[model samples]
Target: MTVTETTTAPAKIWDKAGGWQGVGTAVGILALTRVGQLLMIWWLGGATSEPRSVWDRLLVWDAGWFLRVAMDGYPHGYTYENGVLQGNELAFFPVYPMLIRFAAAIGFTPSTAAVLISWIASIGAAVALHLLGTSLYSKRAGWALVAICCSAPASVVLSMAYSESIFLALVAGMFVAAHRRAWWAAGLLGLLTALSRPTGAAAALGLGVAALIAVREIWKSENRIAWQPITAAAAALAGVPLYIGWVAWRVGDLDAWFKIQTAGWGTTFDYGSSTIKFLNTTLRTGDGWVSISIALMLLVALAAAGVALTQKPWLPLAVYGVVAMILVYGQAGFYHSKPRLLLPVLLTLLPAVVAASKARPRVAILSIVAWAAFGLWYGAYLVTVWPYTL
Candidate 1:
C-alpha cells in the first residue's frame, strides 16, 4: 500500500468499576507525570534557541504549523523556504486547529489556547482510556493501562500542542460506544477521529470489522437483521475516503495528498525497508542515541503485539492495535518518529501490562517506574540534545 492507504472501546459497567473516580485518579497520575517532565525541561534549560521560559516552549516543530493553520486557514498553494518545499497545512487535519481557533477567538493567544487544548484533551483521553480498559477487563487493568500510557516514552507529546491527545480521546470514545453497541455514536466519534489524524482509518477499520462480526453473530442467533448497525458500519468506513476526496478536489489530483506528503516530509510506504536501513545505520554508527531509543521502542511494541496475540483482547481493540502498529512500522520516512507514531497503539500495551500486573504486581510497578524514568529522559533528550521532531 501507498502512504495514503497505509496510514492508519467501550464503557459502561459504571458503578461497579468506580466510575468517574477511577478516571479522576488516572488523569491525576498523568498530570503528575507531565509535571515531572516539565521539571526536567526546566532543569535542562528548555529547548528554545534563545532560552525562553518553559511554558513558551510548547509551540515548537509541528505545533507551529498547527497554530498557523488555526490563525490563518490553509493556503491555496505550496510553500517553499530557501529553495526547498516546506510542509503544507493541507497535510494536517482540521479538528484540532478548529478547536484551537475557537479557543483563541474567545480570549486566549493561539499558543496558550493550543497548549490548553492539548492538556485538557490529555486528561479526557486518560479518562476515556480508563473507562474502556475497565469495561474490557478489571479495574486493576484499567488503572494499569492509564499508568502505562502516562509513562510511555512519547507521552510528553500528549502534553504538547499536538493532535495525539485529541485523537486518543476520540478513539477511546469510539471504543466505548462500540462496546455498548451504540452504533451511531461509535460511527460519529470515529468520523471525528478521522478528521483529527491520518491514522484515524485504523480506528474506522477496527470498528467496521467489529460491526461485521456483530451482524454475523446476530444472523447466527436470530432470524432478524438490524439496519442501524449496518448504517453505522458504513458511516465509520466513509470518513477517511471523504476527507481524501476533499483533498483530491482541492488539488485536482487523486493522489495529491500522497504527493504532498512525499515532497514535503519524505513520507511514503517502503514495506519496512526504511526501518531496516535505519536500524542498520544506527547500529553501525554506535552513537545515534535517537535511533537507538526509537529502536528500543519498536522492540517494546513488538513485545506488546505478541502479548496482545497471546492474551486475546477484545477483537476490535486487538485489530485496531495491530493495524495501527503496522502503519507506524510500515512507513518509509522519519525513522526517528516511530516512537511517537506508536503512541496510538495504546491498546497493544494493555494486555502486557494487565498480564504482568496479574502475575506479579511488584514487578509491574517497578516496570512502570522504569518506563516513566525513561520517558522523562527521552523527552528531555528530544528537546535538549537530539533536535528531532517528537
Candidate 2:
C-alpha cells in the first residue's frame, strides 16, 4: 500500500473528489440537510407578518440587501429605518448578489438561484473537509467531520441566499489544497473566499503564512515558491481599498466608511477588555439567555476541537488553530450572532480531523456521531432562532 493508505488516513480523502462517488455523496447530503431552510424561505417568501414588518425583517443582516440587489441592481438612494445605514450597501459584499444578478439576468429567480448555488457550494465544502480530514486523521475522522458539518445548523445557510455557504466552501477547499502543497489551487480558492466575505483577509493570511513556512522547509527546490497564497492575500487586501474608495466617492469624505459605521450605526470597534465584558454582559441578558448559552458552547466546542486537532501528524494545524482562535473570540463586540460569523473558520476542522484520527476506530466513530448531533442542533438553533428573533 502507498503511504496514505498504509499509514492511517484512508485513500478516499485524497481520491478524486470530483469523481462520481464524491459527487454523488456530496450531492445527497446537501439535499437532505438544506431541505428545512429552503422550505422555510419558500414558505415565508413574500408573506407579510405586519404592514411595517415583512418577511425581509426576519431575514436581517445582508439578506435584505441580497433581496434588494436581486430586485434592483443597486439602489441609488439611502434609508435608515433601523440603526444601520443603507444606500452605500458596503456592509454586504458584492460577490454574492453579483451571482444573483447574473442568474436573474439569465432568467433564474433570485431566491431559486441562491438556493441552488448555496447547496452546491456547501456540498463542495463538505467534500473538501472530507479529503482534508482523512488526510490529516483517519478516513473515519474525515467522514465524521463531513457528517457533523452537514448536520450542523450551519447547514441551514445553504438554504438561504447568503455568502456564508459559498464562502465556507472556498475557505475549506483552499485549506485542503494548501495542506497538500497544491499552491495554485489554494491561491485561487483563497482569492474567491476573500472576495466572498470580510474575513477573507484572515483566510488568505493563514494560507500565505503557511505557504511561506512550507517554502522555507523545502528551500532547496526552485518550485517551492508558489505565489497562490500571496496572490490571494493581495486580492483580499484589494477589496478594502476598492470598498473604501467607493465609500469616499459617495460621501465625498476620505473616511466615509468609518464615519458611516460609527455615526449611522451604533457600532464602534474598541478593543478594551471587552471579550470578557461581552461574555459577562451576555450572561446578564435575560434577553438572549439561549443565544448566550449557545455562543459559549460553540466556543467550547472549538477549543475542544483545537485540542483534538493539535494531536494530529501536522504542526501547521496547531498553528492555524491557535491563530484562528485568537482571531475569532478576540473581537470585543457583543453581537448575538458573532458565533455564526465565525462559521468560515470551520477550516479548523481540517486539522482537527487529523488529530482525531489517533482515536480508536470505534471510539472515533462514536465521538464523531456525538459531535455531529450537537453541532447540527446547536448550529441549527443559532442560525434560525438565536441572535435573530423566532
**Who wins the TM-score comparison?**
1
Q: Which residue pairs collide, candidate 1?
A: 8-199, 9-175, 9-176, 10-175, 10-176
Task: Report lDDT (Cα) of residue 189, candidate 2.
Answer: 79
**CA lDDT of each prediction against the hidden true structure:** 0.77, 0.57
Worst 10 residues of 2 by lDDT: 2-11
Output the number of the lDDT-best candidate.
Answer: 1
Query: Which tens-of-lDDT digit does each residue in 5-106 have in candidate 2?
Result: 222111232456423244445555556555544444444433433332223322556576676766676433344557665444655566777877787778
Listed in order, each prediction's TM-score against the native is 0.91, 0.75
Model 1: weakest 10-residue lDDT segment is 1-10
